[model samples]
Target chain A: MGTTGGPGGRRVGRPRVSQRPDSGLTPRAELLTAAADLFTTRGYAATTTRTIAERAGMRQASMYHYVSGKEELLAELLESTVTPSLTYARGLLADDVTPAEGRLWELCRTDVELLCGGPHNLGGLYLLPEVRAERFAGFHAVRAELKDTYRQLLAATDAGGALAKSELDLRTDLLFGLIEGVILVHRSDPERPVSAFAEATADAALRIAGI
Target chain B: MGTTGGPGGRRVGRPRVSQRPDSGLTPRAELLTAAADLFTTRGYAATTTRTIAERAGMRQASMYHYVSGKEELLAELLESTVTPSLTYARGLLADDVTPAEGRLWELCRTDVELLCGGPHNLGGLYLLPEVRAERFAGFHAVRAELKDTYRQLLAATDAGGALAKSELDLRTDLLFGLIEGVILVHRSDPERPVSAFAEATADAALRIAGI
Candidate 1:
C-alpha cells in the first residue's frame, strides 16, 4: 500500500504507508480500531472480518472497501505502533548527549518507554499466530529493521567504548529478550504500569552495560 | 482420560487409553504421532480430524474409535509435554544448593534446557486457540503452582539478601520472561540450535541476578 516517491528506477528510499488514511477523521478509523481490539483480545485467527465489520457497525462486504483484508489491517496496526517508535529512537540518537554511555542509556530508556508508554499494539502482534506465518512475511523485514536499530545502538556504544566488545551480541539479545519479557508481564496485569517495569529494567540494563 | 485412583480427588497418574481390547498399539500410536505432527506444523484449527485421519492412513470414524475428538487429542499432546517437564523441574529443585541464588539459577537453567532440549509441544498449546480457551482454563491452577515455585525461589533470595527487596517482583517477572522468550526464539529458527541462545541467555540472566 506504500508508494515510493523517488525518481524513476531509484531504489534509495522505501516509502512509508500513511498509517490510517489521508484524513484521520474517517470511518476507516473505526474499522482499524475495531480490528485492533478484536485481534488483540480474541487473537488474529479467531478474529474474523465479519466480526470486525459488525463491531464497527458496518456490513461485512463494506469493510473491505476501506482496507484490503485482515492481513493488511494487521499490517496497518503494526505500522501505526512500530514505525513511529522507531522514528523516535532514531531521533534520540542525534541528541546532545556527549558521551556514548549517555546515548546508550537514552536509547535504552526510549525503547523501554516506547514499550511501556503506550497501548502496546506490538504486544498483540507478538502474541498473534496468524500473523506469524508467511502470509505476512513482508512484516518480517520491517521487524528486522527495527531490531537492527537496537543493534546499531549497541555498536555505537561499543565504538565510543561505553560497552564491552567481548559481549555485544549477547548483550543485545538479552536486552531484546528483556524488553519482550517485560511487555508480556505488563500485558498479563494491566494494573501494573509499564513505567515501573521500564525503570527497573533500565537500571538493571545499565548496570549490566557497565554504564 | 486420566483417572483418580485415590479418594479425596487425589490422582495416581495418567490413565492408559490404549490398553483396551478395542484398541491396538499401532493404530493408537500412529493416530497420536500424526496428530502431534499436524498440530505442531499446520496448527490446531487448520488440522481437521479428517486431515489427521488421512495422514494416519485411516478414516475419521476409525479415529473416533481410538479417541473422543480432536480436542481430546490436543489435550493428550499437551499433557504428554507438560507433565514430564514438571516432574523434571521438581527433580532439579531437589538438588543440593546452599544459597537461594544458586538454586534459582539451577532452576532457570533447567527450565531453559527442558524447553530448548527437544521438540516443544507446548508451543502448539500456546499457539492453539481452543487449547487456550478450554484446556488451559483447567490448567490455570497448575500454572499458578508453577509460579509459586519461582515465588519461593524469589522469597529465598530475598531472605538471603541476594536481591534488593523492592526489585523482587520485577526480577521474578523478568526471569520467567527470559525463559519464555528463549523458547520463542528457538521456535522461530529451526535450522539453528537453541543451545547457543540458551547459554547466552543463561549467562546474561546470571549477570542480571548478580550471581
Candidate 2:
C-alpha cells in the first residue's frame, strides 16, 4: 500500500503505505495523474481503484499506498485543478484596483486561460456529476468567494456609473451566469475560444452599465 | 425471454409487449422512469442495465426485453425531451409570425418550459460524457434551425424599427449567446424557475438589440 495525498493539498482518509523505489517522481504524483485521467474519461464511480491501479501498471493493493480510496482520488483531482487556479485568481484580483469592468475582464481571462489551456482532464471534472455532488463541496466555497469578487466589480461599476443603474443582485447574477455559461459552452466544444466568450460577455456587461 | 421496446421510441428492439397484470404499466415505462432517476442521480456510466432492471423489479435478463442497451436508453431519453419541444416550437413559429423580439421571447419561454417538463431525463443526458461526445451531433442542427427562426424575427423587428440595424450574423450569435447562457444556468440550479431565466435573458437580449 502506498500513502497518497488527497486533492485538498492534504491527506484525507488513512490508506496503507507501501515503500516503493522512488521512480524519481513522488508516488503521490503518479497516482494523482493516473486517477485524474481515468476519472476524467471513465468518471469517478465507473473508474475503480483496480482500474486505476492497472492503468498505472501497479497491483491493486499497491495502488492504495498513495491514496486511501476513490473519494480521495477524486478530491485530489478536483483540488489540484481548482486550488491553484483559485489562488492565481485571488492574486490577479489583488493586483488590480482598476475599474470594475477592467477587473471583471481580467477575472474572466484568468478562468478561461486556466481552464481551457491544453487538452487537460481538468475541464471534464468541472462538468462531472458525481464529483459535483460529492467532491465539489470545497470547490463551491471557492467558487462562491470568486463570485463575490465579481459582485464587487459589478458594484463598483454601478457606483462609478460605468453601468446603468441596475439592481446589484441581478447584475451580479447575470455576470456570473454569463461567465459560467460561457465556460460550459467552451468545455462542450473546445473549438470555441474562451476569449470570444469573454469579449461578448464583457461587451454585454458594458452595454448594460452604459459604459 | 421477455422482449422490450427499445429507447428513442423505436418501433422495436426487444419488445416486452405484454403489460404486467397488476402494475398496469409496460416494462418499458417502468424501465424508463427508473433509468431517468438513476441516470440523473448516479450518472449515465455509473448506471447499469442490471441496476435499472432491479429498480424496475424485473430480472436483469428481462431488462433487455425493453431496451437494446444503455446507449439506446440515452437516445430514448433525448427523444422524449427534445423532439416534442422542438415540434411545438415549430408549431408556435408557424402559428404566429410575430416580430423578432416577441418571437425570440416565445422561443426562450418554450425552450425553458420544454426542458423543465417532459422527458426531463434529457437534461441529465447532456451532462453525460458519452452523450456529450457523440449524441450531440444533431444538437447543432437543431440550434441552427432554431437560430434561423430568430433571425427572421430580428429581420422583422429591424424592418419595424423596433430594433437597431445590425448585421444578422453577429446579432444572431449574440442573441444565442444570451439564451444559451441562461439555459445552462437554469439546468445547473433547478431552484431557479425557467420563467425567471426567460425574463432576464429576454430583457438582456432586448437591451443588447437596443429594442
Candidate 3:
C-alpha cells in the first residue's frame, strides 16, 4: 500500500495517520464532523488538534490543508450552528409576501430543528469559556444579527405591533431563549425527532408573540 | 500576624493562607460564594479546591472542615439553585386554593429570579459535562421533581386540560425550556433587575400555556 493511490477502502486525499473506520465520504467534511464530535464529547479546551486529526483519519501535519489549528476548527463548528439560520432569517426578513407571523413561525421551527439536528449537541459547545474569546466574536456577531432578525420579524407581526416599543426586546429575548434552550432538553431526551420538537416550539413561540 | 482571632473584622474562622479580601463574612458561605464565582466564571472542571480556599481566605486545610472537595462544593451549589424551588413547588401543589395557572406563574417567576439573583450564573454550571455525572444525580433528581410539578400544574389548568394527553409533555418542555433559558440571557446582561426579568418571563409563560 503506497501513498500514490492505494487499493479501494476509504482513502481520500492524503493517507490517514492510521485509519480507524469513520463515515468516509468527503475528507474535509469528515474532518469537520470528527471535530464536532470531539469538541462536544470532550471539553473544547481539552481537545487537541493532533487528536482531532487522528480521529478524522489524517496525519496531524496533513490536516493543516483544511485548518490552521483547533481554533479554526472550533470557529467553523460554532458558525455552522448559526450561519444557515442567519441566512434563512435574512431571506425571511426580505420576503415581503409572507406574513410576519408566518415568517417568525418558520424561523423558530427551523432554528430549533437545526439546533437539535446535529448528531452531536453542538450548541452545548457555546458554554465553553474559549467560545467567549475574541476569536469567536464572529460567531457571536452573527448570532446577534440572527436575534435582531427575530426581533424585526416579531415586531412586524400584527400582535407585535400591538405592543409598546419597550416590549419588543423582552419578548424577543424570551422567544429566543425558548428556541435555544431546546438543546439542553434534546441533550437529555434525544429520542424525539427534530421535526416534532421544532413544530412544538414554533407553536409555543406564537404564544410569546401574542402574550 | 496571629492565628487565634483578628481585631475588628468579618473573620469568623481560623487563620487564612493569603488575605485576598473577599466579602468577609461567615467562612463557609464565603467559600461557597468564591466557588460559585470561579465555577461559573473560570468554569467548573478548571477551578481547583486550593484556589477556592484561597479566594475564600482560608487555608486549604481549614476549608476541608466545611467541604471535603470540589465535588462537594459543586453538589451544594447545584442543589442551592433547585431545592428552594422544589420546596415551594411542593407547597403549591398541596395548597388546593390557588389556581393552577397562578401557581405556575409564581413558580416560573421565582425560579427565574433565584437563577439570576446569584452573584454568578450558577445555572451556567449546568453546561459542564461533569454536572451530568452520577455524583450530581441528587441535583438532577430534585430538578426532575420540580419539572414534574410543572407538568402536574400544567395538566390541571383549563387550557392544559383541553390539550390531549400527548401534548402535555411537549408543552411542559417548551415552558420549562424558556424558564431555564433565561440564565443564558441574564449571564450576558446581568444589569437588568431580577424582579423585572421574572415578571417578564412569567408573563410570557402564560402565552405558552394558552398558545
TM for every model, in the order presented, reads 0.76, 0.72, 0.87
Candidate 1 lDDT, tens digit per residue, A1-211?
Answer: 2243423432212222222232344667877877877776666666778777656555678878888878888877866655665776677566645665665566666666776566534554654545567766666666566666666666676442455554675566666667655555555456676666667676666555444
For each model in turn, which proportion of the native inter-chain contacts is also found?
Answer: 0.32, 0.33, 0.59
Docking class of 1: acceptable
lDDT at residue A203 of model 3 (Cα atoms): 89
Which candidate wins on lDDT? 3
Which lDDT tens digits does candidate 3 get at residues B38-73? 887677767788888966777788889888899989
List each model's interface RMSD.
3.2, 3.2, 1.4
Which residues of candidate 3, in runs, are more than 4 Å off?
Answer: A1-17, A20-22, A25-28, A59-65, B1-26
Native-referenced DockQ of model 3: 0.54
Candidate 1 off by > 4 Å: A1-25, A96-98, A105-122, A127-129, A132-135, A158-167, A207-211, B1-33, B76-82, B124-134, B158-166
lDDT of each residue in B14-77, candidate 1, tens digit only: 2322222223447777678768777766666667887777555566678888888788777766
Candidate lDDT values, in order: 0.60, 0.60, 0.82
Global CA lDDT of candidate 3, please? 0.82
TM-scores of the candidates, chain A only = 0.75, 0.69, 0.88
